[model samples]
Target: MNQGVQGPADTGVPAARGRPAAPPAPSRPDGGDAGPDTDRERAADPGTVRGEHTHSERPLPRPRPAVQRSSVRGQVLDALRTALVAGELAPGEVYSAPALGERFGVSATPVREAMQQLALEGAVEVVPNRGFRVVERDARELAELAEVRALIEVPVMLRLARTVPADRWRELRPLAEATVRAAASGCRAAYAESDRAFHRAVLAQGGNDQLVRIADDLHRRAQWPLVGGPARQRRAELVADAAEHTALLDALAARDLEVVRALVGEHFAGSV
Candidate 1:
């Protein structure tokens, strides 16, 4: 007899020298094969275990926040305002949101949102079941806006002039200079924004938030192009208007209330 493990007598095949043979597959109730060992299969898969529920060891990525809609709406609002100031959006003309959206390469939703904001600003009005119509602001309305702004701003600016130091007014020189440059650029939208910035900076010295807000709103209304007026203002006209900002700053720095009142009055008069 051989001193090692024997082969099957019926098959007449010898066993391997060093390695053990794989175990036979288990039998099912119907005597069919039960396939590979589930424990060994689970061990091979990183996401699965022999006894516990399957899960990944690494964390799943977080979902990103939605920012495109609001951002697009803001962009559309700014563009619409600029178009209004630039006279691209004609007064009394109706514009559908879908048409504007097609031009802007976005959906109609953001355009409608922007148009609604414009409506609140008195720049446009809603047309029932149609679209938005640009408001045809008359010269008298523009003049009234300027008068209201002067009424609100002149007193606050004078009070600030009497109390605030020269250095504080000097600090606003850059803002005034910005208006001059924007005016020279001949972009009505640019000058409008810069002009408001200079005025807001001056009124902010009064430390009254409501005064600034009201004055700014009036200033914005006055900046819009009036009905039957030139589509774009002459560069020289814009430059002349911007120069008043620097002059106002000079008078404020000198604490000359008389000159401040005169300059403020003349500025409002020229606004029409």
Candidate 2:
């Protein structure tokens, strides 16, 4: 608040530790030095030489530059990934980069970058001389990812129930509520988004970043409505999924890993 009273030599500049602070440079013809040079220095003494300013005893943290907007290519890539998961880009289909670039209002460069990212993530396969092909999920890989998530995430939620601070529950309840509302409203996309939030909340224990990232890919895959019989084809069919989450929460509140594992396993299998 005080801006530190321009401490020490009191020139009002934040100084780096071993550098000699410079004296204020001569003002420009119109007025101030219309650039960053002025902000960087302040007079340690009224009439000192250019290099006479002393480094501040107390170091102030420098502010980082602001973030720039995402490039057009990045936006294109994001759009492609979304389209793929939404099933708009049908599984096992080949897409033309030029066509996609036109659809997304981008050049082939960004489209290509986005496709490469997807390919690396296993969402698409590279065909060497050919451009790229839509990724088709294998039943076995899908099952494996789902099962691994259940193994790790269910227990994490149980831990959350046991040890999560009372305040965190406040943050978590809303995601569950959102999941419920999305389901009731029959919005498949919203339901899936909220569903992912619920699992992330459960696994917030231990600040386990590595586990969280691995689980996200699997969660993203599960968000799409799986192709199946007529009963499962309705939008947001898993709206009632709250019951499954409640089951995990109950086991977590009870601090029961066995129940947690069983509940998570059932939920993962049920999604398929």
Candidate 3:
């Protein structure tokens, strides 16, 4: 089980990954070790440096600051979204705020705040004091979202395929390649972010900001990974999906309207 969030009174906070360690303290002017007087003085003062010269002599690090609950809530909400997509959080299953807070290594306040936003997005429903229940999406609802997206996006994609400059398509190649690398690495979070970026770059070429935003929301809802399984199979599936992205870019660059349209339809269909 995931450990609970460390509060101010806790002994230590989990170190953030990839954070560089502080530099070692400079040696004493006389090159003498800290004497008992120095140790006693350091014990009484939080700011004094008193440790061995091999390590940083600064005071122990404290728990991460939680002054900005709003920012923290946004991060928690994103994590919840990924968890839901990965099948780590099941549909129709009720989850308590404390449980989610512990899972996220945050206080219950921010977790509750995040659930409220998810409720607004229709991803979950409040259950009074019991917490929130994940909302189940039926096939009809998924179909409807796809239909709306197709209506708004398919025409734009088709038009961009014919009208957009080849230079623009070339510009998007890096984003498509990033998705492939992310999938090949078998990192779901990396792939998800890169996948969304690839789609957004494609849609933005049409020059319709509102349409892009709407289509992005629909895409996210449809892209949730409901099937949980072995890592190898998941990696293969992700690689296949990434290949489709590359194929779509190739078709667009070639100005193959028929192929582009067909690929777009297949992409949307795969999501549902």
Candidate 4:
């Protein structure tokens, strides 16, 4: 239901949560939900700020910029990816350009641009005379990705554990808490981005930019499939994940890479 979604199959990073918001598009500055500031401002200004100052000074929150129509292509990519991760778009499903073009309300040009990108990302296969076909991911591939993740990630995590001060996660706790809030509220897209943030924060402590980049790619390719469901469907899972953040913090506090590896192995192994 993401705003203005003309197509059903999406490709970028998408959300399979509730319908897209009606007027105030869910996507705004800082991703979504500027939160309490907007609702509270009206009480302070009482609509007078509009006359006294430019609308920018009005007590109510300044309006978010209208995302350009060109950005629609990226939005389309994100929506499609969300649906695919959520399993709404099954493997082997072949989407035609004309069909997708009609769905996004753009011509086939954008759809073609977006689909080609997805295909390059290994999320889909391009066929002759057909549009992008969903990649048929199986248990073996999932298991392989998990193994690769462990191999590529454990050393980087260990380096961070050994070299960085454990208190770094304290600096990261706010983002983790925000992600948890997103999960609790059933905001799939927000939660996904949050999850990505938490992992990167930990890797940042490792101090190796190259390692961080590799770890990121592994996380995205392997982790997306595990958390695509509505947070409620995996309520217990999300709860455990939140606790795992604390566990990681504890390990970092002690500079214990062994514990980090064990925790990571347990987490990813369970997912596979």
Tell me, by lDDT, which candidate is best. 1
Model 2 agreement with the true structure over 1-272: per-residue lDDT tens digits: 45444543565557888986665555555565535554444443543345545332334577643332246766787677557645677766788787888898777777887898888777778777667887666567668777777777766766766786655555566677777776787645556667777877667655988888778777876644333323133554465465677666656666676887777787887664
Cα deviation at 219, candidate 1, in Å, is 1.1
Choose the strongest candidate by TM-score.
1
Writing each residue's lDDT as its tens digit, candidate 3 over 66-112 gives: 77666888899999987866667777789999999998899899999
- What shift in Å separates residue 270 of candidate 4 from its native position after superposition? 2.7
lDDT of 4 by residue, 1-272 (tens): 56865443354655556876234423334455534576565558766445654323325686654466558778887777766655666677799878877876778876777788788777888888977887876667778877887887677777777777656767877876876776676545556666777878877776678877876666656544433333223655565665676687788778887899898887666542
Root-mean-square deviation of Cα positions for candidate 1 versus the true structure, in angstroms: 9.7
Residue-wise C-alpha lDDT for candidate 1, range 32-59, written one tens digit per residue: 5556565576678755545354432334
Error of 4 at 48 (Å): 56
For model 2, the stretches where C-alpha displacement exceeds 4 angstroms are 1-71, 223-233, 254-259
The Cα local distance difference test for each model comes to 0.85, 0.66, 0.78, 0.68
**Count of clashes, each model:** 0, 0, 0, 9
Which is better, 1 or 3, measured by TM-score?
1
Candidate 1 similarity to native, TM-score: 0.75
Q: What is the lDDT of candidate 1?
A: 0.85
